[model samples]
Target: MQNDLFYQELDQFNLFSEFAEPQHYQPVPNDWFVVITDVVNSTQAIQDGRYRQVNALGVASIVAIMNSIKPLKVPYIFGGDGASVCVPSSVLQQVKQALQATVILAKQQFSLEIRAGVVPVSDIRQLGKDIRVAKFQPKDHFSQAMFDGNGLSAADSLIKQANSQYLIEPVESDSLDNNDLFEGFECRWNEIPSRSKEHIALLVQALPNEQFSSDQIYQIVLMAINGCYGDELAYHPITPKQMSLSSKVADLQNEAKIRSGFVGKLTKYKYIAKLKLLRHVGNYLMKNKVKTDATEWGGYKQRLVENTDFQKFDDMLRMVISGNEEQRVQLENKLKQLQQSGLLAYGIHSAPSALITCMVNDYNHDHVHFLDTTRGGYAMAAKQLKSQLATLKSVE
Candidate 1:
């Protein structure tokens, strides 16, 4: 059977406002598979000051699967502690091996447990759920994938179940030949401090009900958010002026560890040293606005900010915004009204700064920045959201 080009052939919509509209999305092909990867005990890891590691693992999952299936563009979403990707059946086994390799790499290098799984889209539909996806291009240089419908949520739930049939357990291996598997995965940027009083990492999930659809509820929430913080990009969590390359050994070593993947001391050191030098050179180029043949250093930061996935949707609305107390309060008050009205459940985690993880295949173009708050961004908000969901379930 020929692999479906559903995602590759789909048209992209430009406006973020249109993301909540149901008409913009199409159902994921039933023959394709949903691949998910998540860090176990991530909330505890974040509390232990390991959010950077958590973010890297999430991006690592995407990088590995993407590199393995090169030239075949698919839809994916990067959560702070994990990631989800939809792939054609043609590469299911290949993709699963990459995921297993990623699982091995995570445990060996980071001492982190990654739960990886694959489920057929047909199964999700069999259970009366669906995965609909759309392409969102906030900037011409980058296209962010957006997911609606409960199919992804169902996949996550299924994968997390104990002894579930879908789980992918890594074979016992001391090391994987993974130096080339995680290409283009980089995390050299220093955390971006909030331009306003605080950075809010928020998640809003609409409830299922007969009165109104999830799309209608999300549209109201988006409008309320815009009302609190104007439609301009000023409220963006990461700004060009606030962005700078990190020189920290710890930051450099995170990428080195993933790319090196349980290699000998000499190889690991070489990886770290190479990254250190790259960081130094990047600092020089960007600080002096040196334009190279590959990238326009002067405009790269602006483009990075424009392309950051600070706001996205995948069955739920996820965002990282910089706003003052007044704006935060206004937004929360509006959210409170929505919750009281039984329209949606929400959670927000406020922090001093936001974190940026990059998957850059090219310096000129082809890069997407993943955003999260420094301490327990999406993971923490998700915890709170889960509690609220329970409360709503009880009342329902």
Candidate 2:
């Protein structure tokens, strides 16, 4: 397909039904580029209680790139500690420059080192790998790119293997004017608590080709849990009680409050107050139906409740869920049953609270969040899970 037709066709591609299948996704255009960004010492920072910064940086990278390349739709994912974005070749140079600025912001503002790069999808294919993606809407205006095959992993590995010329290198800079790209990134709410005040950040992988399709095993696993834990919403961590705004005025830094000038500091204060007021209004709307110019605000809350980001899949099915110790045990036991059947590999990290990082483009619309446990963080948890899967490799 021509580039223009390809872009238009991808916007309409839809074949998967009920559950997304790995095979249904088509290869991304070879001319497009995959830009991967992650905090270099995110695991340590999360341990230092700077989990919010890690999450904010991941979302910030996305906001920066998207804002720079408006009128273009990019496919991306917020991976707890970082993000992966695939942009069309047309904005390749612009996206790289935007990401470079973000790397500088992450370091200067949050004191976090971020690694980012623009990698050509064609180069990945040249390495005998391919990029296949299916777009799925966990929520409207919050579209996620679902990956398949080995290419996504190949591109990611190349990006992180070593700093290359294509990397979005951070420049030494004292200026903080354009650092406001993270305008919507917020961590105002305190860590969400489970009813039992205990939560688990989980990573699960279907044992590759163990006499079963990976997608089949995934469905069975989810069905087993839905059977045990009740409906999907029941296991969602964002209960009405756990949802509230943090009133700390100092938390605005990760929201990308610009501070290059005295005027900027004053502007930050005003935005902080606006955020607090919006939080109160959001809390009220969550409980009570209120009419609005667009639609009822309460319905939006219901939509958020129903469209929780508790579980996600890339090459692995990963989750950060809120529940009691008992609930954790119940899910683990089922997973063990699946494991014994040579169907999957699983790892769990227990935490007291689940952290949320939000990207709020509009008050009433275009809001999405990335959720992860603060303890070991999802990146570390996923590493452990992948190691287990390698040991339990099921070619049997």
Candidate 3:
């Protein structure tokens, strides 16, 4: 009678058959692990106003070290105040070494301290399940006890006991319950803040795709900055001068590599040249010191002509090449005529936009402006007059 009743129930619903299927018992792969690393005292650091610089250095160090660990495909998620990484079981040791190196590098370069913990999982599905279960449990007792007193409430005491046990001996489990038998199993699944979930999701999505080279990854990070801060606070629209400068820097770097036996020597040279050029330009601006808008245009033009860095005055200058060929040729002719007639003065008593526009159209140039820290307006402008001279030459 009992067998007959079971059969009747099975007949009424196909759920039993579904459960009995072979696919339901398929084994889960046990070769995945997660590492969570948090930057220590990040709150104090941000309050100290060292957050941006320190965070950049820490992330750079971490990424560089992670890239060196071979055979291990790891996904690194940056969580603002910390980062998390996932790796395959086969390369667990390598991942550990990389994490250690990241900590060491961060300390050496940015004076930042980091703490990391690892957990192994049979598969991604198991990991998700375990995390969900862990999150449901309470996990912050020892910290509370330290601040309050030696004695803790029932929940706080339970958490502290779990933490102490976990610290003494690490264990991996699919499920841990808050019972008397498992008194020392504090759940830290909630250590990863909710705000960082999006970043974690992005890291997971980026995995299974081809890994990017260091330079490529750097570009990806810089591009992400625009989105990091909302559209309102993002950088202004990229100017033509900015694009041209970036391209020229890349070319110069590539050229240095080709010239030398090394593959990336040009990158170093380009950086050095950029530093030198900026210093010289800054000095010139300080020396000229245009106070009034009236004399600003003439003062800037005279400085550009006198400055050796603006070598390609006519053909391929920086600011003047944005316009068409006819406009550029006209500007060149006007500049030449002014120089010949000796009417090209060093400063303008009163500058007008029409004159500036006419000069730009004639020379086929776009002006590069820099923020004047002392003066509240855009007082410095560079007219890139030559196209081929896009690359800045090293002064020394």
Winning candidate number (TM-score): 1
Q: How accurate locally is residue 327 in candidate 1, as Cα lDDT from 0 to 100?
A: 94
Q: lDDT scores for all predictions?
A: 0.88, 0.70, 0.28
Q: Write the per-residue lDDT of candidate 3 for residues 1-396, one digit (tens) a residue.
A: 132121112211122112112232212124455455556666566556544433333343334334444323233333334444444555566556555554554454356776555555332343233211000001121000000111111112222343432111222221212011111111111011111111110110010124543223323322333234223112221221221112234223322221221223454476447644654554455356635533353244333222111101110111111222333244345444432333221110111110010001011122211111111001112112111123212211
Q: Candidate 3, which segments miss by more than 4 Å at Cα?
A: 1-29, 70-72, 122-396
* Span of ten consecutive residues with least summed lDDT in model 2: 11-20
Segments in model 1 whose C-alpha atoms lie over 4 Å from true places: 1-3, 174-176
Mind giving the per-residue lDDT tens digits that candidate 1 earns over 1-396? 444688988889998878888788999888999998999999999999999999999999999999988978999999899999999999888798789889988888889999999999999999999999999987778898999878998999999888999999787665455666788898889988998878999999998589988878988998899999887576888778898888788987788888877576677788878877887887788789998888988778888888789989998999998998899899999999998898899998899999999988888778888999999799999998899989977976
- RMSD per prediction, one decimal? 1.5, 3.6, 28.6
The whole-model C-alpha lDDT of candidate 3 against the native structure comes to 0.28
Candidate 1 residue pairs that clash:
none
TM-score between candidate 1 and the true structure: 0.96
Please give each candidate's TM-score.
0.96, 0.85, 0.30
